[model samples]
Target: MTKDEFLQFLRDPDVCKEIFEIVKKGGKPAVVAPQVQPQQKFSSIADKLKTVYPNANAPQIQPQPAPQIQPTPQPAQPPKNNAPKGSGSLADKLKFLRGHLDKVREEEQIAAAKAQEKSPAEKYTVISNRRCPICEKDTRVVKTKSRINVEKRDLDYCIHYKDFDPYLYTVLTCEHCGFAAEEKKFSGAWPNKLKETLREFLKQNDMKFPFVEERNAEDALSLFELAILFSEMTDQSKGRQAILNLNAAWVCRCEGFADRERDFMEQAAVDFEVALENERWPINGISDDMATYLCAAIYFLINEYDKSTTWLGRIMNNANLRATAPKLFEQARDMWQDIKRANKA
Candidate 1:
């Protein structure tokens, strides 16, 4: 029993008398202790009294401390897409190719400009040279003329010197294409060797073609041929090239303002559009497919919904691409949906 209840019981003369009588009768009552209602009522009254007047001088009651809380562990999340804004891994490589192409075009333009400055009637000196199989004897070496060919057309100089002088023979032929050239007088086989050396130098310094100038205005058929050639040359480096292209595009997209961003997005769109024009199908390989999906994702991030949707659709529409890059496709679709919902909201 509580201390206060016991004290109350001690204060009651009637309760003390009954307890004394029970102890006097050898601690046994006629009825069982369970049937004792009076004692139970008295005990409850004592508990109430104790609450009303808690004895501060009496034993102090200690409260149980609250239960300790354990932190809930969270699930680990997957890595976020760190690729650039509009291009995928392949974007940078394509950009690199574009740079090379730009260099070639610039060189061609300079050469063309220089050629234009020369008067058509201006007499160009010709020198004699030995008979090369390509040009034959009596071939005259003259200034290089612009011609359309896959290899160095603008940079190549024509031979027209053999007719000018006999002793100072200087004619040379292209090793690969058998294109003939003639050198100025006072030059012998040295001209031929120099031509070979120049050819080698040009080959070594050959720059990659820019995407815009190389593929621009080209029809689907022409693009396909170029793509095929590029694929053959790229081989294992294709993935790396894609990544670099993506990086460059992403940087450009990020730094651009509204109009710039729009322009970048347009350019990105143009790339995929060209790819589609050429292939008319998703890229065959996994690495290529992933690269393509990355391109789509970049478009989405830059808010180019239509282009992004088109690219995603291309993958989803194609049974093979869809099956091969299911996760990538799903991610692109989900991100696109989120963008739509956010815009609506």
Candidate 2:
């Protein structure tokens, strides 16, 4: 109420006793309903407490606002991702970007390595248009600019190369009609009768060509075999067929196909004898003397010593061989000596 009224009430013994009980309770200070007193009258709180508890031995009870139990000061927690700006989202974004950049770099390295690994033969080839006689379609003819190093030339005309072999690409494959032949024959003139036979043969079968540009040893051999089939239907010279088979056999040897190599060599031998008897001399760039020599070489290679010696005897006995072609005579003489030695051994 009024300050004068409050002072009169504090003077009463029961009110003063109640306030004293609250202040004297155990533990920290206990708060009671605060009675407003005039500042001028209640200047010293100790004087009032002493006045209230007069004669009894009372503990000094000073008026104090209740002790404020402030919550404990806790240290701030760091972000789980250890972000600079204390944000996990920014850290996650940076991690994703770094991973993406690494993947990009890996793909680029693979691309560069593939480019570097391209074939060496691609640089030395000359591309020219060649018309296929069988199919009447255009096939690209790829030939080497020049011959590579000649390591050795064998009797059956297989020239071993110290570098890339152009013989592997000698066969021109027509992608349209599956007609494959040597670069010269593939583009050269063909008889109308042979063309008609091939046309009839093509009508009965389905064939597709699936190669271009670069060819592995295996694919080139496959093309050679395909050309052999096409060669038979086209009435290509037996000598020419024998040469094709010999070249294919050489390729087989290089590729480690021993069984197929021997088989082709045997076919070449049979065809060579037929070509010599039935066809004319200088057949398919091979002279009659050369054909006889190849027949001997083929028989020798296949271990047909009887046929080999019989064919070799012809070249050895021919009186005009030394005068016309001394090199053939020399090779023939050397081969005969070798065959006699082989048979004796």
Candidate 3:
């Protein structure tokens, strides 16, 4: 509608009255609808209401363009794991690496501790090649003490030591044929009958070699028993058997087996008597003086004081023995005194 016509319509009393009623009924919507009348006009009704209610206190209502409803943004999807086939998450991978590193460190520590704990005997040994008499196979043996500290002697003259005792490892056993013998008798020639018997015995029995590595008192006794067995098979001198039995008794003594020790000592005394009557002097490893001294010692041990005194008297009378073996003579004299004192008591 033209502005002049709209102004002329406002001058009409009836039109003005009707427009006032619509403005009063329409409230804020009617009052503010033609807010853009300064820039662009609304509908005729809006113009009529604006003209009727041209007061500043009238509330201005905006359309707000239907609140421009923005579509609610969906949460972003997590990226797919495109890692390698065997690869895991960062946390899992770290856990695995930590465990592996801990295991490696533990192994290294154990190895270092084991190396540190190794004894001088285990670390450094005097390795010697000695051929076995029966098998002839060259076997490695720890001969002398790599670390030696010879202390006191036992009652039976067995030398005690602070380091590795060479006596404990005196027997050499062949790995092939399992022929075990004393170091002194290791090279001794065996008869054909003995060899055949040994072969048959080995075929029948599966013997465990306890003397291959570190030997205890029991292992030493076992070696002595093996030596005695080998000696018997080869028809060795009674002197060798007596000495072996004596050594076995000493080993039993060390292991605190009193009954076994006594049994072996008694067997040694019997063998020594057989050696004195039947076998020749200086038979096997025992010399004539050693045999005599051993006889005296054995008699004293067995409570045969008269026999001991007789052997001791023989040692005292032999000037050559006294001069040649001063230590043996001295030991025999001391033992003789012990025998006399025991007799008197």
TM-score against truth, every candidate = 0.27, 0.64, 0.60
- Quick one: best TM-score, which candidate? 2
Candidate 1 local lDDT, residue 46 = 48
What 10-residue stretch in candidate 3 is worst by lDDT? 26-35
Q: What tens digits encode model 3's per-residue C-alpha lDDT throughout 138-231?
A: 7766665546676888545776666555666767677666777777677767676777887788667755373355677777787788888867
lDDT for residue 117 in candidate 2, whole number 0-100: 76
Which residue pairs show collisions in model 3? none
TM-score of model 1 relative to the true fold?
0.27
Q: How close is candidate 2 to the true structure, as a TM-score?
A: 0.64
Provide the global lDDT of candidate 1 against the true structure.
Answer: 0.43
- RMSD per model, one decimal: 31.3, 19.6, 22.6
The parts of candidate 1 lying over 4 Å away from their true place are: 1-245, 252-265, 279-288, 320-323
Model 1: worst 10 consecutive residues (lDDT sum)? 151-160
Best by the lDDT measure:
2
User: In order, how many clashes per candidate?
Assistant: 33, 0, 0
Model 2 scores a C-alpha lDDT of: 0.77
For model 3, the stretches where C-alpha displacement exceeds 4 angstroms are 1-117, 120-128, 208-211, 302-304
